[model samples]
Target: MSDASVFIAGPASWNQIVLLDRLPDPVPHMQFAEESWETLGGTSAGKALSLRGLGRTLLLYAAAGDDDAGRQVRAALETADVPVHWARSAETERHLNLMTRRGARVSLYLSSPAAQSDRDDAALQAAMKASEVIVLDLAAEPQRLLPLATATGRSIWVDVHDYDGTAEFHRPFLAAADVVFCNADRLDDPLAFLHGCIAAGASLAVCTLGAEGAVAVDAHGVEHRVAAVPVEVVDANGAGDAFFAGVLDARLAGHPVPESLAAGAWAASAVLRSRHLHPLLDPHLG
Candidate 1:
């Protein structure tokens, strides 16, 4: 863990991805999937994979159950060479994601992992204190460990996904985060929200805009934007996570915000061109 520069804590799951021409309408109707497969899921896993692809040294801390699905998830990460410290949970997290070719998705969570013990906390806390940055994805465990994370005083990065800007659950994460990322999916005004985040003391706030690209606001209140790299879309499962990883990696290397955004756009293309969370998972997809 001493070699790891980034420490990530969140959910890691085995997931089934079903692709269709478009997101299924909210109705009871049968539809055939254009393609379907099982692979890794969970925002934290995605970030870990992407960061590994970027040649970054990182340690991932996540909960996994003593179940077959949990074994699959753990094996997959080990195969990808993503170092992880696992916590015992009652069950592994699982999700059924129905996605469109153009990237729209509706995720159905099959199971939520429940921590079985607090034995992993001592090690996780040590890793956090040693890391340069601590990334806490949206999960109950990380949320519960917010105080410890804040105490470390390292840079904290968070991905809120499609935050609507009023959820009580997200406030603590937003408050603890130095850098924040989200998509424009549910927000009525993404730019305004970014501004609000800056006003609230975040060093930076970014909103990804699917194909149009991404936008950001720095601590100085200057806005930055980047055009998405055009690519033959395969799956959008982990693009946002990839983008988050890229930006963090670049920033840590002393790149400016605009350059970091470009790095993020490029990183996302790797996932956009793959069927799995990251290209490193391709050989282990089966």
Candidate 2:
């Protein structure tokens, strides 16, 4: 914990990934999966893996069930040498992700982790206090600890994956964040929203566009853009998280916004070529 550069509070789940030709329509029907497998999946887990890949020290705090699925997630992170503090949950989070070759995904939550107690809250708080950056991903635990995170006055980074800009739940996170990242999938106007985030007090705001690239706005009201590093897409499950990790890592190293965005694009490309969250996890996967 003493060497940890960042503290992350969010989910770490075991996911059954099913590669499909296209996302299924709303009608009730069955379709064959092009391929299927289980692996570690969750936004926080992805960030942890990528951060570790970049040689950044981080401590991840997440809830896990007292079950086999939970153990699988825990073991994978341990093997990756990502230090974690696990809270007991009634059930470990699990997702059935239906993805396509073109990068479309529809995730079905099979199980969601529900923390059984607050026994580890104090420890998480101490870790937050010690770390230079605190990343509060969109999850129940992070939401619960938002006030504490604010009190620490550490730079708080939040990723609101596909925030539509009007979801009540995402508002608090948007407001509390010093740095905010989101995808353009649900945003009607990503650049406008990025500027909005800047206007609302975020030091930096980023919006990722799948193939077109990403756009960002810094506190000085300066807009920056970076094209995606073209790559043969393998799996897009963790690309955004990887980008977030990259940008944060580069910024921590005192790089400016444009350079940091390029760093993020490169990191995302690395994940885009891997089947798992990051290439570092390839050897660890059974």
Candidate 3:
């Protein structure tokens, strides 16, 4: 395994920020002035920033349209020093994400057939074969990549964001992954869900409770808990991803479970203190 090689596959988007006095009771529909647009946000950008700060070689596999947004996305990655093996398709469409000051967020996604299409298995296999670890979004086209990861004998890590009560649909992919990280709000009982994930095949499971802390379970059924670092949180957007990157970095460095969790906790806290999701500015991050 190469010490600096990691693969991340996900959707990238251009974010437009709009500040309001308060989120309207039922959401507003007025066309705002041009000043409402603040900054652009991309999930892949955040992930790449976090991983790159750890001195890891990032390989992002995703689709972006043949538009200005796509050009910006590519340019942003290059600026961040993340290498891209992008699979560009003419049918890709740009995604729009809206961020509000009251901690409410919504996304207007323009879906394209090419963007939703599965990645090439052969290319992914080649990358996985040479990578130290593979980080993926469980919400992505798992059917295409999960099996390939399992077949390649690579350590697979998945980020679980949205769960719609259908465990059956997600079980196969979860079982195939080596590590699973999820936000606490996504589950009813985190410990029970960890056990279920272990039963499904995950060797390690971590549940990140936003402000409270995080809990991690190893393959031997041992549980380790890490308390959240004390900080004034400006935004809670990329804390989980920072935590995931920290954990992976520690594990790749051969740290034990407890130490790994500590590193992750520190990274999460650092991200919480930032106004944005850029992980490179985190003081606690290595």
Candidate 3 Cα deviation (angstroms), residue 54? 1.3
RMSD of 1: 1.1
Query: Against the true structure, candidate 2 has what lDDT?
Result: 0.91
lDDT of 1 by residue, 150-236 (tens): 998989999999999899989999999999999999999999999999999899999999999999999999999999999999999
Note each model's CA RMSD in angstroms. 1.1, 1.2, 4.3
Judged by whole-model lDDT over C-alpha atoms, candidate 3 comes out at 0.67
Candidate 3, which ten residues in sequence have the lowest lDDT sum?
32-41
Regions of model 1 farther than 4 Å from truth = 115-117
Clashes of each: 0, 0, 0
Worst 10 residues of 2 by lDDT: 113-122
- TM-score leader: 1
Q: Model 2 misses residue 100 by how many Å?
A: 1.0
TM-score of each: 0.98, 0.97, 0.82
User: lDDT of each structure?
Assistant: 0.92, 0.91, 0.67
lDDT of 1 at 185: 97
